[model samples]
Each structure stands twice: as C-alpha cells, then as structure tokens.
Target: MSRFLYLDNAATTKTAPEVLEAMLPYFTEKFGNPSSVYQFAAENKTVVDEMRKIIAESLGAKSKEIYFTAGGSEADNWALKATAEAYQAKGRHIITTKIEHHAILHTAEYLERQGYEVTYLDVDEDGKVDLEELKAAIRPDTILISVMYANNEIGTVEPIREIGEIAHEHGILFHTDAVQAYGHLPINVDECYIDMLSASGHKLNGPKGIGFLYIRTGVKIRSFIHGGAQERKRRAGTENVPGIVGMGAAVKRAFDTMEERTAREKEVRDYLIRRVENEIPYCRLNGHRTDRLPNNANFSFQFIEGESLLIRLDMKGICASSGSACTSGSLDPSHVLLAIGLPHEIAHGSLRLTINEEISKEDVDYVVDSLKEIVEGLRNMSPLYEDFVKKQEKNV
Candidate 1:
C-alpha cells in the first residue's frame, strides 16, 4: 500500500480534527493562566471548569471529584502513592493484578519500597483476574486495591465491577487504570463502585499530555503535586487549557459515537482475527475471544520474533506493535504475555494490532495477508520451525 495503515490505536490515536479545532483558540486568543485573578484569565478558568464537568459527567462523577493531570501515568502514580500515604494509619496493604500497565505496577513497587504490603494477584490463561482469588488475597489490613479496567497489551477486560464491590465490602479503596478502556468502553464510576479512575486523552484521539483522575467524594487521598492551588488544590500547576479543552471535545465525541463505532470496530477486529488465524500456521490468538475490547486483536506467531514481524509490517506501511508503546525498546519479553502463561518463545513472537474507527475491512485483509507472508518467510529461515517439522514427520 502507498499510504500508511495505522493499526496501533491501543498505543495512541491520531488527534481528532474536532478536538484540534476546540483547542486552537486556547493556544492563541484564549491563552491565559487559569490561576490568574485578572478578568482576562477568567474565561480560561471557566473553560477549564467546564471541561472538568464534562469529563466528570462522562464517568458518572461529580465535577469536584475530577482532577486533571499530565496523563494517565501521573494519575496512576498519584492514586497509588497518595492513597497509600493518607490511609496508612488504617492499613498498609494493597491488591493488584499481575497484568496491569507499568504505570500501576511500577507505582505499586514504589509503595512496597516504602514498607507497604502489596499482593500481586495472578490472572488466568485469558488474563482475567479470578474474583475468588482476589477475595482470598484481601487481608484484614488491606486498605487499597488497584487494577486496570483492561489489559493494554492482551486487551483482556478485567472484572472491575466485581473487584470494586469486593473492595468496598472490605472497606478498602478501589482504583482502576482505565487508560486503555475509558473512551472505548462504557464506564460509569458510580455503578462500578470505583473510588478512583485514571484516563489519558491520547488514547482516545485527544491531545497528548492531558488526562484526569476521578476521585469519588469522601475518598481520603492527599495531593501528589505541590505548587499553585490548581485543580481545587488537589493537583497543583497551571492547567493545560488547550489540552483540557481538547480532551473534553474528544471525550464528548467518543461517547456520542461509541455504540456505532464499537459495533463497526468489532466486526473488523473479528474478521482480522479469523483471517489471521485461518491463514497463518502456528499462530495463536491472545486474550479472551469475546470479552476483550472491541478494537483489539492480539496474536502470537511461532518461530519468529515480534520485533522482526513488526519491522516487516512497517515496511508494508502497516503500523502495529509488539506490546505497550512505553516498553517498545526493551529487550525483555512482554510482562503481560508472560503473566498469561505464554512461554518465552511464544511471548517473544506476539503481535498486537489494535483497530480504530478509521480501519476498514480492506485494511484488515491486507494486514492479515501481509502478516501470513512475513511469518512464513521468517519461519522458513528458522531452525526451530525445521526441527518441529521434522519431529512431526517422524511421528506421522
């Protein structure tokens, strides 16, 4: 193909035109610090507050509960660190799953260094956390439970509502890193009993470097950032007026067209999954077949490295990922793939192709065909494939 076919929406999305339009005025005519008491800045402050309300409403939260941050990582860090510090008097234990994005996992690790106990719960083969195991892991002093709404790499949706109920029943706080699931999925914080939730704008066609943390009213958490009294003194720093405005526009558009977009994306996703598996030998689909995100299709092709496959796909003007964009340069196999019990070799060969509204049936077909050819060509040069073929022939 002459033009690029982007299939890595899971990592980030192209900023929507509407979102860009909404932000343009803020960068030019409306550029004013929201913290300033002057009349000129009042408009920017109003825009920030309005955007916060819109985001809060989308999550079924109060405007006061919404606090804007740099992005999902900052929100995740604040959620884990601030909550742990504030509630340490009550307890010091936290529960999280093994397959969370590094934002949550690494923050949990930081808490452990500070003498807090964290139980990293294991997931099943499909990357779904076991509710029974979660219940068993909760201790008398457990004060918080952090889990992602969905797996970023494998695209497995976790049982967030159930986990939230369990946390509330035990008088513990529940926080979910909804970076991958927020705009793509339907989320109502009240119904799920979530005390805290994190979302990034870039994941949903909004501007980068903007996101929010939803803290349910009455949740005791300290401020992570200390500076000017912004975000109602919960988060400090002059707000990114343009980014916030862009995020609000993006969130509105995403929710407005969510139903139709999800349906269409799922059709393309399923078609891609079926074609790739049917045409490619020794390729296995990762994550839950039906319960995963509507736009996600992850696979593992044997006897080849994921990086090489990704490079070949890139050569064909196809943009895909081996795993999370954050860990793209790492030599280690995906922690998420290993968490789901994939061996080192299989995990190394994993490929993640995430679709968006722009992806079409033709694009899916092209990708699958290109992938089949690439995998076959790479495997033909592999000693592993030759050995497996020889063993099979001898057995026959």
Candidate 2:
C-alpha cells in the first residue's frame, strides 16, 4: 500500500501539536470545573477566560461575546433557533441561502414546522447569493438573515458584508456560519456588521467537538440549552475545558501564521487547478476562480461518478472527498453544485480536494497525475462520452 496523502482538510484537520500541548494540563493537572469556587477551580477558570479573550480578540470581538459550544453545528443551531424564538414577536420571517450547511438549513426547516416563515435566497452560477434576491426577500416581517461566509462543498465565499447591510437596513439580525472561513480568512464581526458568527475548532487544527459563536453585544437570543449557569446562562452543560484551551491555542497559532499559510495554500490550490486543467481533458472547476476558499479545489470530470472517483483516490492512499462526507450517503448531488446551475450529471461528477497548509507541490502533482489516469479510465466506461464522441464524429 502507498503512503496516505491527506487532502481532505475541509472535513477536519489533525489537531496541531501546539494546541495539544496547551490542552494537556487541563485534562489532568488542572482538571477542575470552571464554575467551582475553590482555589483549584480558579486556575482553570482563569485559563478559560484567557482562551475566550484571545479568541475574541482574534475576531475583533469582546471576550464576553465569544461563547463556546459543541462544534459548528451546535453553534449554528443556537444562533438561528435562539434568535428566531426570541424575535418571534418582531416577526417569524427569516432569510438564508439555499446552499447553507445542513446545520443551518435543517434548523430553518424545523423552524417552519413551528410556524416560522423562511425565505431561501438563491445563488448565482458561481455559488454566490444574489444580493437582489436577498433585498427582495426582506419584508416588514423579516427578523433575521443567516448566510454562510463560505461554502463547504464549492468553497465560494459569499458577499457577507452586503448581506449584513441588507439585513440591518430592514431591521433584521444577520448571522453567518463562518465555520470554514473564520480562521482561514480574517473575519471581524464589526467589519461585516455580523450579529452572529459560528466557527469550529477542528477546522483550524484544534480539538474536535469545540466551537464558538460570536454574539454581538446587543443581539437578542434565547438559550436553547438549560440547567447550568455556564455560558452566561446562554448555553448549559459543563465546559469542554481542554477543548476550549486547545481551540484558543489553535486560533492564536492560525492567525499568527495566517499570511504565510494563506499564500502557501493558495499557491497549491491554484497549482492544482492549473495542473488539472492543463493535463486532464474535459475538466471544469466547480467554484469561482478567484472568489473561493484558499485551500479548496473542486472540479468535475466529464463523465465519472464522484463516489467512484473518491474510491479510486482512496485506494491510492490519496485522501480526498467528492462532497461533504456528512452528506455522502445521499445519492442526490450536492445541493450547492445544483444551486450553482450545474446540470445534474455534472454535479454528480464533482470532486473536492481541500488541502492542508503544508501539502507540497509534488503531492499535488502526484494526485493530478493520478486523477488524469482515473478520469480517463472512468470516462472510457461512460456511455455518455462514447455517444458524445460518436455524435461529434458523425457531424464531422
């Protein structure tokens, strides 16, 4: 078997060593409840506060603004449901993109059953929400707009600032699922006029099951969880002390090295794009050329199933993904690809390779070379391609 090449960083990244080091003590030496009033607990409490402070500072927010949760899904859930329930008096109408992660989309659906109205804004061919559609969606009843900062499958970044302005102009709250964009891209809640932002730690080389939601100072939201006095009584349950510590360390390390990391990742991403286009036949990139995530490279083969391509790459010890593994079991093409105006066949043939900050040129070259072969083999078996060829030949 060949050595594995992990390129699925978007799904999750290996926890950084520095982050692990920071979290170690919390699990053993300093394992005390942050709420405990004893001297022993005071030590851990101080650490949690520092973690909150640094994370908040990195996002240009106040320490109290950052509330930890169990990864992006929970944060997204809390942001939408909490705000909807609290602001139901104002209106039951909400706006979000059709391509939002299930965390937000499903929650919005659940809200509909509970008598809330939701307007799902459509995106353009590049997977960007149409600002005009968003503007038109707003009404006197509009209460909130929850658009993602960047797409998970296609990697297209949204016009969050514009969306925020639109929401505010209509007297509505704006939330962004920044799970994929927070650490990789600089995000200031104030700059984007963001009322709420969700970020996951594992996406930035921190411990899994730890995430934070940035709630603007005056944003009105009710608690979904109950029982504890934790999270300023906003969220309940015991604090994930070690996970919180690790997340802070990871956030600090990420932004500290952001520029260098961004440049390298972008270079590799563009190189992969160039190589696949320059080397493979009938390949088309799935997202915006320059308006996508720095580490995301998604493409569609002319006539191949994404699942089959994923397995081929996997057998070669190349860890890539077709779409979000969270939605892999579903035979339906990614809603993102479909929303971007891609034909069903094209959407089904998509491949996503999200790279690490450290993947070298050679690794990408190998993957590109392997892809060229795999796609050719897959295309050979494709009756559609064969028919296309025959039709072209007859026309000639």
Best by lDDT: 1
Worst 10 residues of 2 by lDDT: 162-171
Residue 389 displacement (Å), model 1: 0.8
TM-score: model 2 vs. ground truth:
0.99
Cα error, residue 16 of model 1, in Å, equals 0.3
lDDT of 1 by residue, 366-389 (tens): 888888889999999999999999
Q: lDDT for every model?
A: 0.93, 0.91
Whole-model alpha-carbon lDDT for candidate 2? 0.91
lDDT of 2 by residue, 26-89 (tens): 8898899999999999888888999999999998999999999999999999998999889998
Evaluate candidate 2 by giving its C-alpha RMSD to the native, one decimal.
0.9
Estimate the TM-score of every prediction. Answer: 0.99, 0.99
